[model samples]
Every structure is written in structure tokens, then in C-alpha cells.
Target: MMKNIILITLLAGFGFNLNAQPLAPDFTVTDSDGVEHQLYQDYLNQGKTVVIDLFFTYCPPCIALAPTLEDFYESWGGGTGDVEFIGLSIMNDDFNSDCAQFKIDHDVSYPMVGIDGGAIPAVQPYYSGDWGPFEGVPTFVVIHPDGTVDFDPSNGVYDGPGVTGLLEEAIRETGARKPYHLTGTVTMPGGNAIGSFDLNIEGELYSPGQMLPGGLFELDILLRPDSTYEISAVKSGSYNEGLTTFDMIKIRKHVLGIDNFQEPWKYLAADANSSGGISTADLIQLTKLVLAVSDNLPNNDPWGFIKTDYLFASPANPYEEAYQGDARTYMF
Candidate 1:
């Protein structure tokens, strides 16, 4: 939803409608090391968020977003760190020496794939086979750690800040669950039961739903078993600006790449009203929390809001405050 409406003179075109799937389709892609990684198992399942930038080198916007994308990669690391950024040149002219030099000049630290063809499919298999001609450049997709495509490239991420905000939401969702067990039944369109159907929760697959002798049968799963919730909570009374209401406004500024701070986590942390985004309303609530007028935020006290990373690019963390940036300083 944080996408920009920019119809630039692109070298390529894309038209695809990707929705949130029960499980993100699988595909193998190799980075510079020639080590192929299964999009879901290798990264998403391992607690690494994914950002795939589909672009053409000739396009000015594509070239422009390159450095910002690199910053995003370093800001949130892959797997252990937080995010995995991949840049694919989806152009007709092969991504040869010229394209390679372009990346070098841009200082892109993430992996690049999809070269030598006007076609693309190996990356997002869900939309790979019969989706579209995909007539556009500088598009992107954000896959959550749970292997769900929160924002598919079909919708198109118009800019760096837009993509950055998407990544922050994915990271926040990762910290909300640690695989708690719950059960449910799968039914078909009619009154009949869809027995023995495999159940998927938070990306991971479960055994087929059991078929009982008499009437009702159910399946249970441990949700997000692989998720390591980095941001635990954004509570009140934290001296740290990143964790406190101070970062709330800072997050708004960062969404537009303003001020000295630029991060996806801040965007998620600033959404105090739980309205699905940070706005002036969240700032008002943050003001109350800071002034002791309120004890709880609408979206506060959850495991998802507590971002393990800090505002600045350094080792310093939050003080011993209940809802601060430093995960180490957490008491609750």
C-alpha cells in the first residue's frame, strides 16, 4: 500500500496480479557464490526476509533505486541479520560486462540474477508460469520470513522508500509468533469435508488432516516455528529514542528517506494505532504514552513491535527499559 504511482519510460513492462498465498511457491536461484538457494527454505524459513528487485538496467528509475536498495540490504541483513536483497536485470540485452559494471558502480552488495532474456520465471514461481508478459521495470516483491509474499511484484514497488516500508512490516510480523500450536478443520465448497488435505501455517507445511471414522476431523500446526521475533514490543517509558515514542515520528520521516535515519523497522514501530500504518494519529498516541497519559498502545505490548535492531548503524542498544530497541534490555 505504500507504493508510488510512477509510470516512467521503462525499457520493459510488467502486468501481473500476485496475491498472498498459503505457501510461497518454490524456486532455486544462485547468487555470486554459485550456491543455489531455495527461496523459501534457504532464506524465509531460516528467518531471513527476502526483497527481490525486478528491474532493467537501461531504465533511469531502476538505476536510481540501485544504491537505495543496497542501503536496504546493509540495513537489514539476510537470515541471521533480517533481510536478503536480490536484484535481477530483467532485460533483453544480457546482463554482461556492462550490467556488472553498473552494479559495481552502484555498490550493490546484494545478489543479482535473471539475465540474458526478456523472460522471467525462476524467481517467483507462484506468478512464474502463466502470469503475464510482465511489461514493466523497477518492480519488486517482499516475502515475509514465513514464506508469504506480503507484496508481490505484480503490484509494483515504485521506489526505495516504498520497498523499505514493506520490508519493515515483514520483519515486524516475524517477531509476533514463535510457533504456537492451534487446530482447525478444512472444508470444501459443499458440506463435504476435505479430508487429508495438507495444512500450511505461517509458511511451514503440516501433515494431512486426519479423517476420523464418524464426523469431524481437524489438523493442528505450530505456527512460524522458524521465526525469531526480533522486535518484541514498542512499550512506553523507554529512554531509547528508537524504542520510545521518539522513534515514532522518526519513522514517519524515514519512510520518505528524510532526516539522518532511514529504516523499515521504524516504519513498523511507528504504527502505534494498529491502523496498518504510521500516521499523525500514531504520533498523537505516542505523545500520550510519552507523557504518561496512556499505559498501553493499541498495537503495543505485542511481540511483533519490539525491533531488535537500533535506529543508528552501531552496536549501542537501548537502556534497561521495558519496551526499547535493545532486545537485551527487555525485562518483560
Candidate 2:
């Protein structure tokens, strides 16, 4: 009996793990549109080749590659000769809305579904490797028609040529094609060392996993220029505190008193409002200051130059204090 079993095993592929199934794991998830999708029944097991990517929108590299992913999906997704693409977002709490908005903003045409903790391990093969390690976001996995993984695009450096070449080969083999490009860098506010904070972009919050040797948080953003955007950072679940700190970054287009000053100040001269050569508006502003009725005054016109209470001592005289407590300085 032992000899017969050994012969059978040798005939079948001796080194193969007999208990290892060649089939991919099964799962079910709901898309952004509230539709339930079964992985094996509706996609893989039905003779379709699928590409699954695990990511969250707040991840900078993930956001940066979004356009490329969208372009690829549009070219070859959903019944395009047995090829399908899906994005799995792994965000918690408030990040859900942000991820949803990111999909819309980036014009991601494919379905982006949210997976709970129970479903995380079922998809681990796509992210984990035989070396007992896992690659984070922007990971890609190609599932073959026979239900086994044909190519794992994770663990490799994300570059345009390499990614495109591998994807092209996969396309030729599986008849699945999607136009994709790998670009962008992961960056955080305050020079990439955000202490222990997470950034929130378009409502999605991202925590910088573990502090590296440099004490920088894991918050990185991938972005393209000439695009309208807003980004903020928080201390994870402390939304209220995070919101306050995030809002403190005031963005203004004009300078107050100095041309190159970096610190905040409380005053500007009457002539400072003139951007396109002083006109009637400037005179009107001066008149309001003189009459102590200027609506734009920070805390009542202190100079009283408007009231002629103070006069210029010289043609090049520096601006005098407008009020008793006003210590405003000029920035030139």
C-alpha cells in the first residue's frame, strides 16, 4: 500500500503540496452604489479574469495613481473579454466619506467597495507573499481563469515602465487590458515629519502607520498640479482637536504689511489696500479712518491720521501708531 501511494504521488507532481488548493478564496462585498457582489460566483468562478487592488483614498501614492487606474478601468473593465477590475478600500470611520468622494473626484469608473475586518484575511494572498511579508497600498493581484493567482503585482517597485510592461504581459495572457501609469510621491505637511498625526484630504483620514527612524508619521499624499485641492491633518480619532489645528492654517492671497514677511500681523496702512494703483476706494478708506467710521478697521482707527489728530513730520516719515495699544509694523 505504501509503495502504491508513493507511485501515485510521484505521478501527480511529487513536490506539490497536495492539500494546497489552486483556487482563489471567495468573498462578498458591497460597492459604493449599494450593490452586493460575490467574488467567486459573480466574477472569478464564472470564467472571468480579475484584477484586485487594495488601497485607501487618503494614501498619497494611492491618490496619485488614481487617474491612471481610472484610465485603465475605462479602457478594459466590465465584460471586456472576461476582464474585470475592482478596488477595495480599507478605511475606518470618517474616512469612508472621504474615500467615496475621492472615487468621484478622481473619476474612478470602476466599483470601489469597503471591506470589514472579517473579510481582510480572505484577500490577504493578493497582498502577502511566500516570504512571509505583505506590501501595503497600491498592491495589485491578477487572478487567472482557473481561479488561481497568475501574477502578484505587489512587492515590486512601482515605476511606469515596469508596471506597464507587467500589466501588458498580463493583458496579453488574460485578454484583459487597462491603461495604467505609476507616478507621484508620498508627502506630508510640515516637511514630511508630521510627528504623530494623520492627514485628512477630501474628508478621508490617513494615519502614518509606524514612526520611521526620522519620527515622521505615515501620512503621505500623491497629487498632480493645476488641480484644485484641500488637505488637512489630524491626530486620528481626535476629530475636534484635529479640526482646530487644521483650520489654523490660514491661506491668503495678499500680504498684510510686509512683502516677504512670514509671521502673522495685525495692521496694514490705508494705502496697502490698493493693488491696482490707489483710486477713489483708497481715498474713501482714508476718509472712513479719519471719521472713525471705517468698516474695515480691525479695532477702531488708532492712528487718527484720518482725523488729522496726527500729522506727518517728514515726507519720508514712518507710519505712526494708529491706536494706543497698536504696535503694528511695516513689512518691506
Candidate 3:
């Protein structure tokens, strides 16, 4: 065990305890990218081993060790592997942008959180002796999937390559499993790519929906293996994009049976109240939305997702005979 140690170089005049906390305390912090990560829910509960590197923006040893940490992060599949790495700012006033810039300067690819991103409070328990003894900057902590903390996991080896090796060995000792990935492109019926949209992911672990930017959806989010997820894509705002008086006429006709919708999705789209059926009420709601009397439809989103593979029981009239269907469920 002594040979496997990576002694960390402190910021000078500071010391660390040889003993680590038996159980890791939990925390939630947002990263520079505005992504929220929770310790127990997002990683450990999902069976991942997490390595936390705590440092201030200008710490000398932290700066020098950045690149090696980046290499270590990539070795674990850049957050897609069983191991996840995060850099946290120990300073109380470092902004999210500061952490972002620090990562750019240090060429670190892993997630970095700063004071504005909730790093201060997140790290307080560790260094304040609430969790255990922690005495300095540029400290490395490895938390196993079992929620056990391994402080000074690198055995105080401050050198880059050696520290990386020790951290890897420590992670391997935890027996973490590779993460599952939730990834795919979101597009409209006409194959129009959506640049940004909200994602509601629910499964063994529930993450509040976040509007994932263009790159992340396809790049994939790590998920718990063998767990099921119900995903929904929602795009809102621009409440009256294609609505007009002429469309209102079409709805009126469909309601009166003078002319009916040809496609099942048309009924889903035309049902402005989400009442499961088309009627004069839908036409009135459409009229209000189109005329700018109201900015939204009653009980309905500006847009709703139907599974790409969903097949309506009644193709011509989706609402025929109290239809109960899978149109509202999505999986990736």
C-alpha cells in the first residue's frame, strides 16, 4: 500500500490528516457548463467511483497537476467510464466563468466547478472537519460506489504521472462498473434537427429536466446499467408559430365533419386543449392563440412529442372510441 501511494504536494504551510472519512458526505454542485451534478444521486448511486480534485484557481501544485489529471480523466473514458473525475474550486469567490477559464488554461477536459457553481458549500464539509480531517489545497479524494471515502488516494505522490497511476489503482480497488449511456438525436417529423430542447430523464435516478445544448444529446449522458428510462423532449415558446385564421377554419371543418383530418398526428396537433378529442372547443382555443388574445393553449404545451414509431389504432381518427395509446411515452 505504501508503494502504491502518490504523495500530494501541498500549497506549503498546510498539512493533511493521514486518516480519511469512513463515509463520504454528499454534495450537489453545478459545473462551468451549467450542468448540475449530485454526489450520491448522479454518480455513487449509479455505481460509479468518483475522484474529486479540490483546489483553488491559482494553486501552483494544482496548476502543474492539471494536465496529468486530464489524462487520467480521459483514461476513464472522459466521464463515460465507471470512474468520473471532477475538479472543484476550494476558494469561496471563484465564479463559474473563472473555473471555465481555468480549465481552458490548464487544458483539463473534466468537469470543473467554482464558487458560484456551489463549490464552496459543497466542499465545506470535507475541509471543515464535518466529514473528516482535511487540511490543504490540491487534495485528491476518491469516493467508491459504496460511499466510502479514500482521502489522499494518491498516497501524497505530487508528481503527475505517478499520481494518475495511484488514482487509477484506487478506483480499480472500488470495483465500479462501466456506466450506461443515454444518447440520440432529437428531430421533428420532417427530420428537422432541434438545436436545443428540454430533456426529462427518469429512471432509477431522477434528474430534473435540463435544456441540453446541441452537442450533449448525441454525445450521451452516463446512465445506470440495466435501468429503464422514460425520456421526453419538449420545445416551447413561439406559441403561435404556424397558427392562423385559415388553420382555425380547418379545425372548425374537422369538428363539424365537413372535412376531417387525414392523419392521426393532425388530430394530436389540432387538439389544442389536450382533451383527447377534437371539437369546437379546440377551434376556440386555436382562435384565441392565433388572434393573440392568449399566448398559450389551455393545458397543452406549444409542442408535444409523439414517439416516432407510434402507430395509432385509428389512423384517420386518433380520438375515436376513447383511445388509450403509447403516443406520450418516449424511450432512448
C-alpha local distance difference test of each model: 0.48, 0.45, 0.68
Candidate 3 residue pairs in clash (backbone atoms < 3 Å): 6-154, 6-155, 6-156, 6-157, 7-155, 7-156, 7-157, 7-158, 8-156, 8-157
lDDT of 2 at 310: 24
Estimate the overall C-alpha local distance difference test score of candidate 2.
0.45
How many backbone overlaps does candidate 2 show?
9
TM-score, predicted candidate 2 vs. hidden true structure:
0.42
* Clashes found in each candidate (C-alpha, N, C closer than 3 A): 13, 9, 10
Model 2 Cα lDDT, one tens digit per residue, 44-84: 76777777776777777877777776665555543354567
- Between candidates 1 and 3, which one is better according to TM-score? 3
Q: What is the TM-score of each candidate against the true structure?
A: 0.42, 0.42, 0.47
| Off by more than 4 A, model 1 | 1-22, 78-80, 96-99, 116-119, 123-135, 153-157, 174-332
In angstroms, the error of model 2 at 134 is: 1.7
Deviation in Å, model 1, residue 88 alpha carbon: 2.2
* lDDT measured at residue 19 in model 2 versus the true structure, 0 to 100: 33
User: Model 2 off-target regions past 4 Å?
Assistant: 1-22, 77-81, 93-96, 116-122, 125-132, 175-332
